[model samples]
Target: MARFDQAEGLRRMLAGPKPRVFTFLSALKEDEKSGMLVNLGVTLARQGNQVTMVDARASEDSIGAWLNASNDQTLLDVAQQQRTMKEAIKIVAAGLSVTMLTRNADCMAKLPPEGARQLSRVFDVVAHRSDLVIVDSEINLEAGFPLASLDDSELVIQVSADPDMIKAAYGLIKRVSNRLGRRGYGILVSGASEKEARLIYTNMAQAAGRYLAVPLHYVGNVPDDEHLRKAAHLGRSVIDAFPKARASLAFSRLAEQLAMSARTTLGIEGVPELGVGLGI
Candidate 1:
């Protein structure tokens, strides 16, 4: 038998610098949200996008589920290591192409004296190393937590689409905008839907723009893809199984849209830039 040539494979997979932050609500129980995120991440990765999901919530039903995490380590570990955060995450993920931040609560209980400064530096480094730093913050982590660290992102996309959900998203968006210190722009839509995805979900988009006052780029509504079920059952990304599927296509389109948005609107050319300072 021959060696798997793991290093060679990684060199091929992570080739450029593209990082984006996308944190979701902790309100979603792990069983529901984590699978959706895994579905989203694997789909994006297959499109040749580098994505590192930080499980900020570390709840029983989040990225915490993957490592059997009892606490969250991404922000803390990244901040503590400073320059090493990017290298550490890439190395860890390179070791397992589809991995997430472990859930370690104690690690996040309180920040060190210069924790915020360390995190900002880490974000700068990771932004250059990966195609996208898809962070997952607790849905309602209040304002002023590390969620604001996404200040550097081109845009902070809020992910709820239902009207009732949009109502809650308003409060959430208000806090985030206050944290980021502006009107706040983001994608406001759901993850999964039925056949005729557009028809089923387009109304949600219309309502979001009307109510939330934010442009809601509709990431494709995932069908009840069997591969998603299988992967969740086995605790693996569907890309590791059915690399070519509707779910995969949706994420690819989403990644493309993000790249486009970054170039035109994120204030900087073809990458994200911090929009507002914490005025509130």
Candidate 2:
């Protein structure tokens, strides 16, 4: 695999279209979130997009952990000048790579001012090198993201059909809105049929709009499929391991919709700037 070059990445940032960064927060189990991220990343990469999955949570259930990435090296190390970008990024497939934002979730908050700035620069370079960056993250106790740039990225809330999960998902949106103020968020329902997903999205959207005045876009859903679990057990994405599986088809469709959305929004004015210095 080719290594990431900082100079080239910087040039790309300046000359090419802005990369789309989507930070996902899940109200489901940890394994479910990790599985969704892995399959989605693989599907996007298979579609010929330059995709990078950044594990911002750094917990045992994070995407990095799901991929069995070494915690010793991370983007934080690169920012601290202890490791190179190439060393930090692990290429999982042709166009898919995974990197951990930090070894610990609280590490970002502990960084000094200069360190925080350097971390922001490192993240900027990494994001520039990819066409799509998928961030597996969680809002901290203070309802702030680990990186300031994530505050400006597209925020997606993942939920299931379970009542508890739906409630938790809505609570998450409320917490984020309380901190970030009014902003649109994408909704992704996992482990549900089309009808169920639509209903879930509608109810949640109505509540959000009526109470919080926040707009929620339905990004689509992933149906319940045992093939997803089997693929994960085989250390492969459903699209790759079980191409004809229902989950595989769902993932492909989801990836298509997300890619289309990204293209349509490309070069649009008023897109929030990313990779700003961290204040968290």
Off by over 4 Å in 1: 1-19, 67-75, 81-109, 139-141, 154-166, 178-181, 191-215, 259-280
Candidate 2 deviant stretches above 4 angstroms: 1-19, 266-280
Tens digits of lDDT, candidate 2, 49-106: 9999999988888899988777788999999889999999999889999999998976
Estimated TM-score for each candidate: 0.65, 0.87
**Worst ten-residue run, lDDT, model 1?**
271-280
Model 1 Cα lDDT, one tens digit per residue, 1-280: 1233455335434542222555555322357567766666665666666666666656666654664532433545656663244334433244223223433444445555355546555655655555666665653355644433554443443334345655555556566655554343443244445334343235544654576554443333444467777766886776676767655555455555654453443422233222111111
Question: Per-model C-alpha lDDT, please?
Answer: 0.49, 0.83
Using lDDT as the measure, which candidate wins?
A: 2
Tell me the number of clashing residue pairs for each predicted model.
16, 0
TM-score, structure 2 vs. true? 0.87
